[model samples]
Target: MSVEAIVNDVKTRADVVVTRGQEALEVGVKTLKTANGIVVEGVQELVQTNVSAGKELSTLVQASVTKAKTDGLKAVASNPVAYLPEGKATVLGAYSESLKIVSKTGDELAKTLKSGVETISAKIQGQAPVVAKARKTATKTVAKAKKATKKAASA
Candidate 1:
């Protein structure tokens, strides 16, 4: 082949290489941006869920305390019989019920928080395979594009 023909061929190949490199760089940047976006969305969901759980827990705790207080007052309120020797059992029973109320509410709050965390974790896990598949597809497409461009340049 003539020197000029060889030089032109080399120039064409170089141009193809440069174009493929640019495409790969752009794909890399886009993949990173997409992954970061997904992560940010997942984190936002987690934060929102946690906030909701906290509010519900606060409300439950308040209601439980209020009920305990109201019931205790009612049990001993303005009753001479309540303070008499026969009223000790009544007072102790009210206190026991009050403790049971607090314990049950505390257990419920723990379950709520646990359920919230598990839901968030499940959502995060759910997004993973999708992102992985997207990345895999992108990688395959980039590879195919590179191969086609190189073949066209050679021809």
Candidate 2:
């Protein structure tokens, strides 16, 4: 083959590699942006749920404290001689109720977390095919570039 013909062949191969590389990069960027948006949306929803749950827990605690104080005062007024033991019992009962509230709150938080994780997992899984396509394009671009380089050097 003429030297000019070899040179032309090399230039054509280089152009094809460049075009394929650019296409792959565009696909990758688009995929990344979509994935990032999905993750941000998921995180925002999780945070909102947590904030509301925290507020509810705070309200419940405040109510529990108020009731415990009122009940303890009533017990002391009814029987002054047994005030110490009655006060202790009242305090213990309040603590037990508080513990139950805390346990329930914890369970709710766990459920929220589990649901959030599953939703995010499903969304990410949906993007798998797009990601794979981008990866395949990149791999093919690299292989073409390598083959072109080898041929150009030999020529």
In model 2, the worst 10-residue window by lDDT is 122-131
CA lDDT of every candidate:
0.49, 0.49
Residue 84 displacement (Å), model 2:
21
Model 2 segments more than 4 A misplaced? 73-155
What TM-score would every model get versus the actual structure?
0.40, 0.47
What is the Cα root-mean-square deviation between model 2 and the actual structure? 20.3
Per-residue lDDT of candidate 1, residues 1-155 (tens digit): 99999999999988866765555455445555444443343344344434544555566557656655666766656553433333344445545655654454344334433433443343433332223343554345445534644554455
User: What's the lDDT for residue 78 in model 1?
Assistant: 54
TM-score of predicted structure 1: 0.40
Candidate 2: tens digits of C-alpha lDDT, residues 27-100: 54544444443344334434444554555666666765665577797775786554332244444554565565
Assess the local accuracy of residue 56 in candidate 1 as a C-alpha lDDT between 0 and 100: 58
